[model samples]
Target: MVSVYKKILFASICIFALSCKSKKEEATKQNTTQQATLVDVIIAGTQQLSNTIEANGNVVANESLEIHPEVSGRLTYLNVPDGASVSAGTILAKINDADLQAQLSKSKSQLSLAEKTEERLRKLLAVNGINQADYDAALNSVNNIKADIQLLKAQIDKTVVKAPFAGVLGLRMVSPGAYITPQTILATLQETNKVKIDFTVPAIYADLIKRGATVSIINNNEPKRTAVIVATETEINTTTRNLKVRALLGGVPINPGAFVKVLIDAGKQINSIVIPTNAIIPDATSKKLIVVKNGKGTFVNVETGLRTSSGVEITKGIAVGDSVVVTGVLFVKPNAPVKIKSVKNLTELTKEQ
Candidate 1:
């Protein structure tokens, strides 16, 4: 009887311990179900997306010309200083004009005498004091003198060099007292108020590049300015398979021959859903986006369009107003319970960064 009671009491203690362990296990499971993984999410929305083509480009002055004399003579007077700003028609240099000046003075004197003779002949002819033939000859002499004076003045004007347009001058290549010819370069002038940017893109974009399209310029990875498309080559370059394009950079001063990067918008604006670039999980086969639905993380295969600094455009598999797990994307798995700690738009997140 003592052995049976001992055995029964031991069995009852074992049963009691088992029941307590079972309750503890159930409570632990409940706690885990309530505690969800915290994550930062953002509601996807439609954004205007533009397709852009990037290419290397160079800067050129809007109007660049080498200053040269129209007529050859000794550079007698040079008032143009190196790198000086000159207005349109500003005299930059002067050639020898002493001979031309002398001829002009002599012609003026002869013209004055011929005019007096013609006036006297006209008065006499009116009163029939001289014949018509003689008066005609006197009038012809006055006209001939006037023509000679005009020719001398023209020759004198050729002895000077003037700025063609308002611009900044480059280094003077010639000095006063140097004999310069029509081919001799005196200096260079550049209109820097606006600049031209020449770039080429693959011929596939020829149809997209049109007049008045806007492009962005970058210098050494920094944004420099914006330019507008002025023109494009009609025929594609056979060797390069590229289309030459020109744009004007207004309100931004860039020197000619500067190398820059050009970004051309090749597509029209389209409303599309976009998400943060970080939100994408690129896989070998397809790209995936972590979308939170019904409090669980779901991986959805997505097709992407244009990728920009702002965000990545979602072409398919995601809609506007869907919440995407931007933060903690790599850590989360499919169907895992998630609790959104905070929500933000992609634009807002970029601003904070």
Candidate 2:
């Protein structure tokens, strides 16, 4: 009878212990259910956003040429020094033309003699002392001699090289009295008052690019520069399937053949709803944002536009003045109770970071 009474006491102690554990678990679950998620929210507003396309490009001079002589002769005179700025029609160099000069002088003498003979024949023909055919022969001789003089003059002009346009000359390759040929390179000349930024884009963007469209450029370690789209290739490249484009840069100095980053403005400025980039949660087909409304978390679907450095442009879904949850997004679900910890602007949030 004493052993039965001890067994009953042990069972009662076990049941009491299980009841206390169950009560503790029920209290813990109730506490968790009553807790509200804390999130940082931001007010969406309209801002001006530039729509641009980023590309790689190279800089080039507005005009460039590898200057060379048109004829073969010894360089007698190099009037312009190396690396000198010259205007159009400025004498650059002269080739030896002593033989051609001698020929020119002889032709002038012959022309002068033919003129005198023609004058005498005209007077004689008036008196009927010479036939019409004889006078015509004298006149033809005068014209032929004059043509010879003009030919010699053209050959002499070819020996004197002049600058084709206003530009800065590059290094000099030939010296005075150096025998050079038409194939010999004298130097390079480039007009760099402005520059051309050449770049390429995929054929898909062909319709978006047009003449007079503006673009931004940044060279190595240089500030951003603006350029205007001057021209584009009509045909697309088959190998790369890209369209070649050229833009003119003014006010900013750039070297020829310099590698640069190009940003073409594809759209004009317009008011767009922007929000913090962290607030967006991208899914496979769409993006989601946690919007705080009436102290609750609301999931919203949004269509995105231009993406900026600090924020992203929202074209659809959330409207202006809507509070978007930026913090504690991972811990919250739709329609869950939420407490706003702080409301900050997108730019302010960017600055704080």
Candidate 3:
């Protein structure tokens, strides 16, 4: 009976030891869970965004060219009524074609003589008084002389420069007596009644704008004027990544080549997740941010777009409902328990200094 009692006493001591050890382990786990890092987080969300981009533009004329002489000669007549409008085919300048006119007159006289000689040869051939070869030679000479006369007349016509279209003329660089060449810029002629605005918009906005769309023109803070898009370049500029666009403003009295500003509105982006720039941690290959899930920090790689005054756009990785740890990015440990002090809206977090 004494041996049985000793066996029961040993069993009770073993059970007591096991219970104490289990309780110590549970207490250690509770202490670890309570010692969580405190952090503030913002719920990731999206907002409606409308983007406006500025463009530098210049006023252009519907038709513009430098009045250049087709041939080199002394100007015998120049009709650049400085800043005056002229109709198409109006004679703007006249080169001294007196020599050409004299040569044409002489050619006409030779033609008359050749024709008379051909007629005489024809009559002789009709009477069988001359060989066929002789009449043929005289007829060939008359035709050659007529061709020479026409050539001289054409040369004389080229000495006069006529306005190609109805346009306002610039100041004359040469006088009536000034000798000019084909390289000389006599004056500038531009049709400014229908002015065009040539500008460049960012290539990202290319899809938002097309031919027949309208752009706003601001000339030195003047009232905004509307210009209808007339043309666009086939491809974007490789260096600047801008698309060249041309817009027309009819009946607007803006001088050609004047500097102007343009505004392009690329419509809204709805429900775009944006985050503070500081929350992003630069990785070697990708950008990353911290997201809180189940009271633990999780690192996520994100794609970005369209950074503006507000914040950077989060294109991928983080969802709309995820809580992003913005305030303690440097202190937050990945996959570690974090005590979220409070959940704030994105706007409230962004407004923090």
- Clash pairs detected, candidate 3: none
Q: Rank the candidates by TM-score, best first.
A: 2, 3, 1
Candidate that scores best on lDDT: 2
lDDT (0-100) at residue 212 of candidate 3?
91
Q: lDDT of candidate 2?
A: 0.88
| Candidate lDDT (C-alpha), each | 0.87, 0.88, 0.86
Two-way TM-score contest, 1 vs 2, winner: 2
lDDT of 1 by residue, 179-283 (tens): 889999998999998999999988877877889988889977566578899998878999999999999987757778889988877767788888888888999
Which residue pairs show collisions in model 1?
Answer: none
Error of 3 at 347 (Å): 16
Once model 1 is optimally superposed onto the true structure by TM-score, how far is the C-alpha of residue 199 displaced, in angstroms?
Answer: 1.1
Instruction: Sort all candidates by lDDT, best to worst.
Output: 2, 1, 3
TM-scores of all candidate predictions against the true structure: 0.62, 0.64, 0.63
Residues 62-133, candidate 3, lDDT per residue (tens digit)? 999999998999998989988999999999889999888888889888988999999999999999999999
Q: Which one wins on TM-score? A: 2
